[model samples]
Target: MSDPKTEEDIFAEVDAEIAAEEEAAAAEMDEPIGPSDSAVDGPGAGVDALVAERDELQDRLMRALAEAENIRKRGERDRREAEQYGGSKLARDMLPVFDNLRRALDAIDEPSRDVAGGVIEGVELTLRELLNVFGKHGIRPIAPEVGDVFDPQLHQAMFEAPVPNVPKGCIVQVMVEGFELHDRLLRPAQVGVSSTPAS
Candidate 1:
């Protein structure tokens, strides 16, 4: 007893429903997915994270290597310094004995030298032996005498004296000798420097 619907009306309704469904599906796909979505997970995501981790680890490794190299260099410098200055105090104490030996040899008179030949020979031999010991331990003496140029780096002026024939600022007399170890001055020579004579 009911009348049949026209084909055009049925077709229009079905087409409208299909269009709405298609639009809704497109909006859902365009929306940004949050962490709740399982779409951006799996082996590909794990590979990317691993690549970032590897880069950070490589950077840390390079820094660690640089720090280690710096420590090694510092240790080497400390060791060299220790070796160079280890016996400085002992060497300084032995200098007075050498000075006494030199003074004893200087005090002997030329007239009495023949009578005390054995004593003079013993003293000379002892001085040579002491010098040999100094050479063995890298402790050498510097004996800059009068008429030498006054070197502030190796000599300490005790007084200035006017002396003829010697250039001004030259050494007039050496009061005490200097000493060096490995090119470094352990003690500066005590000296008298020359000045121009008064008119």
Candidate 2:
């Protein structure tokens, strides 16, 4: 059989339970609150980390944009060059034909021209048309004449000779005219340079 509980015993038991709960709460309060020590260095550390990450990303973005701009510029330059001088090889091949036509005209004497006047007229017309087409395509002649100063950029010396009254480094004779495609030289004019010294 169980004995009945006294009022004083019950009160004492309740006081002990209350004390245990208070002790537990006090222990919790004494310990650190929020994140643990290993989780973060200090206040504002997380913000600094985020700012560094943002700066790195921004730098990468700028570099990417700059590279893209350079690629675009290079492509544009290539396209312009293609447009301006794409048929340079064909133009160069056709030069011999022009030379032949000019030779034909030059070889025709007055009597031969009188005998084949129609054929001569046709050749002249053909030559004129060929020149017109060349002009339209930005292909032009670099015609160096005698007495002009020899320029390595536009003239190729076929021979060097000492001539009277001609200054040194001057073009004594022109063998073949040069041609250019746009701003680029397709060929330099073949010339004879004088090696005469100034007296």
Candidate 3:
């Protein structure tokens, strides 16, 4: 019959196996625990990666902030423009009505106007009221007087005239008055500019 193993012997064998496992574990720890790549080479490897990531994130954040600011500024500009030029088209359309009224008043001579006093007074009153309304709404005529300096921005020359005493590039006559709404011009004045004398 085979002899049975002693308890002490079994315990010593178990202890030896435990010691071997500890040695193997120690060897594994001494070798290296993670991937043997450059990430574990030195402190600089991890630090560089972290710094690059931080810089990339910072750049992205700055770009996002700049884009947000640009959008806000664009919205503000559009709103201001809309408010400033809101009545431009309608104001422009009504200018012809004013022109016809002026034409009707001009067509009547003084004798005829005196003959029809009531009709003339009614038309004049209407013109005065219309002008008052135009003043209230910031609409004004750009009727330059004769001998005034010609402005290309405000005047459109209908014909050139060589006046005897008027300076060259000066207004010789205003054929049709212009109109403006606030600082913007609705139409440029039809004018006659003095010409330079021939050499």
Q: Backbone clashes per model, in order?
A: 0, 0, 0
lDDT of 3 by residue, 26-123 (tens): 55546654666435565344445545655675567568667978999999999987886788898888888888888888899989987998998888
Candidate 2 on 10-50: residue-level lDDT in tens?
A: 54655565556556655655667677742645544544555
What TM-score fits each model? 0.73, 0.75, 0.68
Name the regions of candidate 2 deviating beyond 4 angstroms.
1-40, 197-199
lDDT of 1 by residue, 1-199 (tens): 8775554554565556555655665566566767766465632454455446555755675686679789999999999977987777888898888888889899999876989989988988998998898788788888887788989998999999888776789988887888888778889999999988655
Winner on lDDT (2 vs 3): 2
Lowest lDDT sum, 10 consecutive residues, model 3, at: 38-47
Model 1 is weakest, by summed lDDT over 10 consecutive residues, at 42-51
- The top-ranked prediction according to lDDT is 2
If the candidates were sorted by their TM-score against the true structure, best first, what order would they fall in? 2, 1, 3
Return the clash pairs for model 2, or none: none
Global lDDT of model 3: 0.79
lDDT order of candidates, top first:
2, 3, 1
